[model samples]
Target: MTAPVVSAADLPRALLVGVDFGGKAFFDPSLDELALLAESAGDLPVAKLTAKRRSVDAALFVGSGKADEIKALVQLHAAQCVIFDQPLGPAQQRNLEKHLGVEVLDRTMLILEIFAARARSHEGKLQVELAKLQYLSTRLVRRWSHLERQRGGVGLRGGPGETQIELDRRMIAERIKAVKERLVKVKRQRGTQRKARERSGVLRVSLVGYTNAGKSTLFNALVKAHVYAADQLFATLDTTTRQLYLEEARARVSLSDTVGFIRDLPHALVNAFQATLQEAMEADVLLHVVDAASPTWFEQVREVQRVLADIGAAEVPQILVFNKQDLMDESLQPRTDEDFFELEPGRSVPRLFVSAMTGYGLPRLRQAIADCREAEGDGLINGDAFTTQPYSESDDQPVIP
Candidate 1:
């Protein structure tokens, strides 16, 4: 069957804003990410508003003063939508819209909308819809506030105080329940596939990291599959796996690309995609790819680690891969500096510096994967899992340039 068509005239123009909220590390990636979301939703980003804050106002995420500023900017730029880098509560969203005189979208909803548009596979679509429903279920009052005028019953007497938002919330809650049931079946099907792979005795290596950190790019280069690799955040939503042949030693392993993680990942999404992340948790090895050239790479690493922890994959064996080596220092001068996490004097994981785009250090990276694979007993599971040997918690081994 043919799919429905959407015309260009239906697109909206939007303004992107990043909120720092004081003293915290400002992650500029969220603005770029917001732009991606806007583009995915067929909107144009005309301006941005960034500010510091101690805490968000319960009514307006940005203070009334800042909200007024944004309101004026929205009018000056004639923007149809305002996108925030932080999630806004239902009351906050309603308050912001009423003050701005324009629609306002928070980080979570904007991301969910993008996922809704990008989801292709049945499971992917179902997961996205389920997450959207859950999010909407929580904020149904904010969405259908306009319907409060039509609460009359079948009889001439109108119902006293039944608001449209409450009714919509009920509908969304029911829909969420149905979606969860569907996802349960999808998860079960995925489980069967995973078990089949495990029985094949092939080493499973999952690539995981912050969004746009080059996981998909490296996956494409290594497995030679043209899975969508872009500079935009969350460009790839669905998990893609390919068989990788490492060496003439007949090393066979399945490398799976997982949905990229981000800071403040909505709980709804996390819950909806639990089965997808299980693929990573069950992997024999994890390639924690980082955009080495990014100024915030360290924070990105921490955020990815946090997500892994949330998904219960923190203890899994991981090899740190610093990608984008073409952007690395040209001198190739080896630096002995250790990251803050590794500053404990004797805590470290294997690390590799490489460029997925330029193909620099890729051979070494692949070789390192093979070496890690060799460390595993019978070439299955993290070798550390099977061995009682005291693994030394040492600094990242010095890379041989």
Candidate 2:
């Protein structure tokens, strides 16, 4: 993984730990992405440790020996925290904190922290708060040290700590319900807006891709709107929409830029952001932006597809916009402006090469969008346009080709 863009002086020092269980297929072999995540969450990674285990140790996820090694490294580097690349059980997490003598966090918490920091809009903040509350609800036992102590009072049937935990849990539950209700109302408002757009017969196109894949840059280039575009992960958290008037099709198309996806995205996040992600699900066409210059571009593509499937946007017709072509070497550049990419065994989608930062191949992208608009019009005239599929919840599954 690329080194983090943060200076050690400016960010809290952290030690990264990754465990390799023999049977797990989703583990990152290099643990570089974890470093990126740590940096994205405002942590400066000072050292990295990896362990190979047959299975997780019951008491500590990495066993006592590895824990000691990590502790030594933490002391050596003056690290303030240790981050694990995998999720840990509540007990295991508490145990790690006690053994290491420092704050311990897992990937889920790191992502949640980043979301909490990056959320800008009211709806975005509410969603992040809800996800954080749900995550925190599961680990309340570790938050307080006196959870086992008891108290006796006139109306106190339970221990003081137990009562506190119960009260906090109940408050969180109520807040979650309130947030969900507000989100439902927001979803209804969105649906009404979508119906209005549909009645006007405007084509909806959404930009979807992995985080930091130039989706926001492309959106800015296409519509001339200054939605935040930065080199960091998740530069833009809120979904922004604008109208793009296509000269070729002689029509104004609704273009939306939504949140980017990452590998091993938490289920709580996926559920919390459903109101925002519904833009992609309801889109007439998806512009799946991609970073063509990255070495792991294919893996990134698969990860984005997995999230799309999770959010019920897999079946939408997608046109892959391979962004950042200007950064690619000459030999790796595509010969044509547009071609077909086989995303799965039987699924082939249109692919276009473009550099959103430099306007290279952008005319071709506009032409492609215009072509899709024309095709939709032709289908409507012929009474054979593919009907939009009704959105439904489904179990998250790996998308195997």
What is the C-alpha lDDT profile of model 1 across 1-401, one tens digit per residue?
99878664556768788888665655474476678667776788888878878887888887899999998899998899899987788899899889998898887887788778878888888889888888777776776666766575653333456556666676677788888899889889878988888899888889999888899999999999999988877788899989999973368888999999877788889889887898888988898898887767777888888889898988777777888867766554235221222412344465566789988778876776776667762322223322222123364333321
* Per-model TM against the reference: 0.83, 0.89
Least well predicted 10-residue stretch by lDDT in candidate 2: 392-401
- Residue 389, model 1: Cα distance from true site in angstroms: 20
What would the per-residue lDDT of candidate 2 be over residues 229-284, giving only the tens digit for each residue?
99888888899999999897788999999999988788999999999999999999
Best candidate per TM-score, number? 2
In angstroms, the error of model 1 at 159 is 12
Alpha-carbon RMSD, each predicted model:
5.3, 6.7
lDDT of 1 at 62: 78
